[model samples]
Target: MNILIVHAHPEAQSFTTALKSTAQQSFEQQGHQVEISDLYMMKFNPVASQDDFTELNQPEYFNYALEQRNALKQNHLAADIEIEIEKVKRADLVIFTFPLYWTSVPAILKGWIDRVFVSGLFYGGKRFYNHGGMAGKKAMLCFTLGGRDYMFGENSIHGPIEQYLSPIQRGTLAYAGFEVLPPFIAYHVPYISQKDRQDILVDFEKYLKHLDELQPLKFPVLENFDEKMQPLN
Candidate 1:
């Protein structure tokens, strides 16, 4: 199966990068086609601009070099955008790997969303379920968190982290029509031992091996993943 792994986080030696590395190695070993968009490594611009809008009749053209053209179009569309979306259309299963930041996805990954998920590409009007641009895809999240798992509890210091990422789990990916599996959360990243890190890496390999089967990530009702979640915190 074809897989798209979008990674965010600056440090190449970070636990987050380690996770991405594990995922990549796993897929390669299994002979699955995998593509990665390392947000920091790519130096993906996080801000948006007016050209992404233009006049209503201007036909919404995109150019990333503008540093503010509203969005990135060319290369990424065929690469990042098409990689996962088409993998959904042609194959099955899309996985996103990142580090949970401020209880949400890193700003650059969000920017990837804003830039790539454009009209007539991932969504459109009329048909509500499974009929739009990305109706039948499957998606999952694999992320590492800095604070202890307890810190994400209801009354903890950071509030509910799972709840915080609902926009990504529900609004963005699921809205695009990928059936989301139970998100794989790796908590307490900053506190792990070298051995512990290695173990998680091994575990990630196992996750990829199992995920190799491939399936669509979608839901059909109101309490479902897409329509019911609130926006990012």
Candidate 2:
């Protein structure tokens, strides 16, 4: 299987980076082609603007949302999206690895989603989502957290970590026709000792193998579920 690992952490030495490498390495060892797109190290722009939609091939249709996006220009937004779209087009499995921040993805990663998962391209067209253009693709989220595992529980401070990914899971992946797999999370980034991290890596390798073998998730692209995904009158 061809897999794409999208990593968003900044520092290469961070534990999150290590996990990203481990996941990629395991997939390669298993003979699956792996693509690693490092958002920050690549100096990714996480902002979305009309320039993003600009078609060098079709200049006349240059989009106008660029002017409306200046407020977000301070962040590197659209560059990541443009690159990720290409990577997504190449993979069968797309895995997102990052740390949860303020109960959501880091701003840069969020920006990646905001830009690439746009209309017309990823969705919104006649017969756009019969089975979802990318519907047969698979997606997974892997995260490392600074808080204790207990804090992510229903009675704890943050609620379940799974709840944090609802938008990416339901709104993005599912909406785009990808199957959502249970995310792999390591809750106490600061607290996990080297031994624990090692064990997690071992478990992670097992899970990566599982992902390689599993069937892709299926969801058709539809403007609305009530309507048929295919063309209609």
Top TM-score model: 2
**In candidate 2, what are the lDDT values of residues 1-233, reduced to their tens digit?**
88998899988998889889999898888888999888898777776655563233334564433322331333423454546777898998899999988777888888777776655445554424344557678888898888887777788877876677777877677766777787888868787788988898888888877864655444444455545544321
Question: Whole-model lDDT, candidate 2?
Answer: 0.72
| Candidate 1 local distance difference test against the native | 0.66
Which digits, one per residue and each the tens of the lDDT, describe model 1 over residues 30-73?
A: 88787777878877766555434332233355344332222223
Poorest 10 consecutive residues by lDDT, candidate 1: 67-76
The positional error of residue 64 in candidate 1, measured at the CA in angstroms, is 14
How far does residue 192 in candidate 1 sit from its true spot (Å)? 2.0
Per-prediction TM-score, please? 0.73, 0.78
Clashing pairs in 1: 49-70, 138-217, 178-217, 179-217, 179-218
After superposing candidate 1 on the true structure, give the runs of residues whose Cα lies further than 4 Å from its correct spot: 51-56, 59-91, 127-129, 153-160, 212-218, 222-233
